[model samples]
Target: MVWNWQQTDWPEFRYDSAALASLEETFLLRAGELFGAFHHVNPNDRDTLRIELISDEALKTSEIEGEILNRDSVQSSLRQQMGLDSETRRILPEERGIAEMMVTLYRTYGDSLTHYGLFSWHKMVMAGHRDIQIVGGYREHDDPMQVVSGPIGREKVHFEAPPSNQIRAEMDAFIEWFNGSAPDGKSPRPALLRSGIAHLYFESIHPFEDGNGRIGRALSEKALAQNLGQPTLIALAYTIERNRKTYYEILERSNKSNEITNWLVYFAETILEAQANTLTRIEFYIAKARLYDRLRGKLNPRQKKALARMFREGVEGFKGGLSAENYIRITGASRATTTRDLQDLVDKGALTRTGERRHTRYWLANTQTDQSPIERRGV
Candidate 1:
């Protein structure tokens, strides 16, 4: 029988600080840099970036659990929560539920984590879903909860959670520690390390019959926000999704081992990656702002809409840039008008034309000039 963390001395999760010292320093430094960059963004761009970041986090968290949500609906739900205009005309209950939970977690970053709070969050996340079998509060039965992989009849048990009876006491202890621990106090554990431990511990407890993974990730984000003294836009789930296989393997390995140094290291590295990715997005937003300023009076509404789409899609924005037909479809313009618009953009140097005749397409010109904000910062 594999001994889980609960079978150990409990509450005391020990690891060598010297082992993770370098990583801890690196993560903290990067997190500081990301936060500093965020502070420099103008109010308009900051709000836009916040919307994008939260939407990505909510969508990716659900996607990790094999639940694919419509991105537009999620965006609309988040927009409504943020008091912005929603693009989607209709919102699904699932989208609204996830968005509500995300906004709550973000806005209430300083609040104490409680049993009732977790129950409410679970209820909100599971609200209006007809197919889920688990109740919102907690597991009521004594059935063993196991995580398994492989074929249905020949499943390989990866890990078994503590029996249902242990959940109440275990959760209470978790809540207490989470509420009390501070990164800067006399007995200090780095916030990133606490985030990793909290995540693994919550998942191991398996308090809910379902949605454990999503909730566990959300708890980690909450811990990070508390440490920073503000809400963070770092999307850890996006990084985790890219490293999904390694994520599960490390969790199982740590659960079975006496030392969780490896898990801590992995968690630190993931935070670094997430912060770096977020920095890139911030840079992109800065670039977008500069581009908009440059073309403020040069481009028409259709051109501006098309350019916005290109910026949003990044490298994935239409393989060879957007063609005339594509522009027409997006802007609801007739062919003749679309042609004139495209030519106008090319003439104004906002876009560069490629190929000829029906094969012609337009790509955003190099918008960063010598004096642009992104260029000034050497980005």
Candidate 2:
């Protein structure tokens, strides 16, 4: 079966720009919203936002590859790379690798994509591995790089990358296209279009032996960031990982030919969804900042500790939702104190409770995604 790169017109992707124009416009509009919200984030707080969002994308990107790195380790590594932390501490190789790549991507996204830059990213991704015929360089193995699944006898090949000898030329052209197709390049494209195409193009080549998906996603993130003139806050990998099965299906389908309008639409919608999710996170942070202001000196030490712990879990609000036992565990309070603290939290609007008696669960009350308090007042 012919793949996209095997086509006579391989890599000359075709799509209806009109079909994606609306999505492109909406993307810009939402980006404006995000920029405005982020603008209000206190400079110090924006650093925290950067660390959290970048760490989340790093974690989710790795999760997509079926490799789960410790989230705390990822964040800690990011803190160090981003210069937010300076206390030298031991970090696992696996954790430090992706964090370093992400931090580097965020810092140098505007720089042109080159062989050395990509090699650097590949080495960062395959940090601790002792195996693999090639780590930071293109695969020179004789066996075809086939993506497959199923048991030994019934293995089904999902896709196979171009042969090793073809990689250098393919990557050279891809890097050229990536740089030349940017928003301000000689052949400029819209934000989402450039990002979507870059991702599809890079994935079709599957240039590296491993971490191609992660690096491809990173390339797309760079593409998006280049358009906006800043590092993107959108959780592209996190959003894609939610519907991973469908993501693979669409990608597989798109790889068969270069007329990739469907793929572009799918990817743009994913970016839009990611953008919204990011906005919610920013608004949640805004709400957290406001809540802290509201709660100053109003709560006991236990409540303060509990609230801080809950907020640490971010907008998701402590896994499985916060419970009285959870609060007690967090604050080391007795049953009576736990009940009182929970009730007091609910009363003060710091948290909202659901269920009753033994089943009671709580979440930060102000984290309404529909609107932030500042927005609701029409500020």
Candidate 3:
């Protein structure tokens, strides 16, 4: 099947901008409100949000390509690269490379998408790998660059990119299109539209021997961030990873034509979903800090320790909710003391207990609270 890259109107994408109004509205609604709420988030928590977004993007983008990175190492590598707390621990090479690429994307969102920039990103993404024939540059081998699946003799060719001989020229055109379509460029497109097209355009070229998917996602993030005037910090890759099957399906279909309304709508919806989830996470952080402030100096040491453990599980707030037995395991308190401390935490507005008797389970109070301004604004 012929791809868009081989069409007569190649690189001259066409779509009805009017159709994106609903998506653009939702996009604006979430982005405008969420960022305003960000101003109210504590500086420390905001840093946490930034790290989580970057590290999560790094990890999920890799996982989409079947590379499972160590979450702890990825986070640590991100913190170190971001210069947070001057993190000095050794980072595994896989984690370090993706973390570096993510941080570069975050820091350089406003910069022009250049060949050098892409090459640097490619080098970082390909770090720790010794066998790639074209590290840090476009593939030079004459072999076809094909996206395929299944066994050696029974493979399915999903899509094939442009010839390797044409990569440099294709990439030059892609870079020009990318920068020229920017918010500040000659023909500025809407944020989601530009982002969607940018990602599609980059992926169709598939310039690198490895790491094209990761870099394409980065370009999309940069496009969003550049238009919005800050790093979006949305769980874009995370959301896409969860819907990876649909992502590939839509991408494959969109590759067949330049009329990409379906692709844009799908991507826009994905962005909106990602932004909403990010808002929930941010609200949780704000509520968490506020709860900590409210409970300060009011809890016994065991209660404080136990509550902290519960919160360490993040927005989901401990698996299956925290149980008294779980509390005893965490705090080493007697069953009697664990029961009392858990009860006291509930009474002090520090937790919300659900179930009863042997079925009893508890949750961090902030998760249940309807009081956070962040949550209120998020709606």
Candidate 4:
């Protein structure tokens, strides 16, 4: 028989604090470093990073549920949410809806979470999917809801949510606990731990007919933001999406076992990894910004556009540095023009070239060194 939270001493999750003690300290320290670094950056850089992070979160969270959304559309949606122009593209309803939900999580990170708030989020998630029979609220029927995989007949149910009748009571208790444990509430809980628990608890309940996974992750994001007293640049969903199999396995294990220590440990470690990744990205952003500053007004329009594309693509900017062919593709320049641009960049010392003929590639001259910004900062 599969064990569920409802049967395991309802509303009181047991976890070993000692098990998470060291991890919690490390996470808090790293989180502080990330937030501190973010604070020191210019407002433009900050906005750029926020757009990238939020866009990644929206995309990855949906990807976790096996839903693929257009990356450009999502970024456009996030730009609109930030009150910026949509860069010559009309906002798709789907993009607008998901962006609205993500913005709400960030904007109201510190607000008292309520059932109505969650309901609104659900509505946003389903805004563009009119064909789906499921509505934007709690399921009315009590049919068993299980996450399954494999062929239709040979499907395997990973886990089951609480019965429909139990959703209201379960959600009520969850909302009360969540609000009561806010930083200023009567029984304040550690923000990190509370986020992990909230995620697990919400998924276990599976209140809405659809979009539970996304909403649960959004809630986790909000919890982390609230804990940090500001919006976090880290996207936990990116890490989760990468380790999706392990994510599901841990959730299943936590649901089946009475002791949630293992789950907490896993969740904390995931957060640690997410924070570390965010720090590395921030360092990259700073490095790229500094590089642009140095190269400002030194390169022609084609060279500048090619360099900007390389920064946007990051590690995968090119298989090697960047080939003339790749430059042409990115900048829509003629072969002759592309070659001239590449040579101009090399001449200006903004890019370094290597290899012979088609094998030749170019890399940011200043970034030829292997050290990242974090290392340079001596962190």
Best by lDDT: 2
Candidate 4 TM-score versus the reference: 0.90
* lDDT (10s digit) by residue, model 4, range 171-206: 889999888877877888786788888888888888
Of candidate 2, the 10-residue stretch with the lowest lDDT total is 370-379
Cα RMSD (angstroms) for every candidate in the order listed: 5.1, 4.4, 3.9, 4.0
Clashes of each: 0, 0, 0, 0
Error of 4 at 264 (Å): 0.9
In model 2, what lDDT does residue 45 have?
A: 88
Question: Model 1 over residues 208-258: C-alpha lDDT tens digits?
Answer: 988889899999888888787888779698878877887887888777755
CA lDDT, every model vs. true structure: 0.78, 0.88, 0.85, 0.79
Cα miss at 259, model 2 (Å)?
1.3
Best model number under TM-score = 2
Task: Sort the candidates on TM-score, descending order.
Answer: 2, 3, 4, 1
- TM-scores of the models, in the given order? 0.85, 0.94, 0.90, 0.90
**Global local distance difference test of model 2:** 0.88
* Model 3 worst lDDT run, 10 consecutive residues: 370-379
Model 3: per-residue Cα lDDT at residue 277: 71
Residue 254 of model 3 has an lDDT of: 89
Deviating ranges (above 4 Å) for candidate 4: 86-88, 319-321, 334-337, 347-349, 352-357, 365-379
* Candidate 3 local lDDT, residue 75: 88
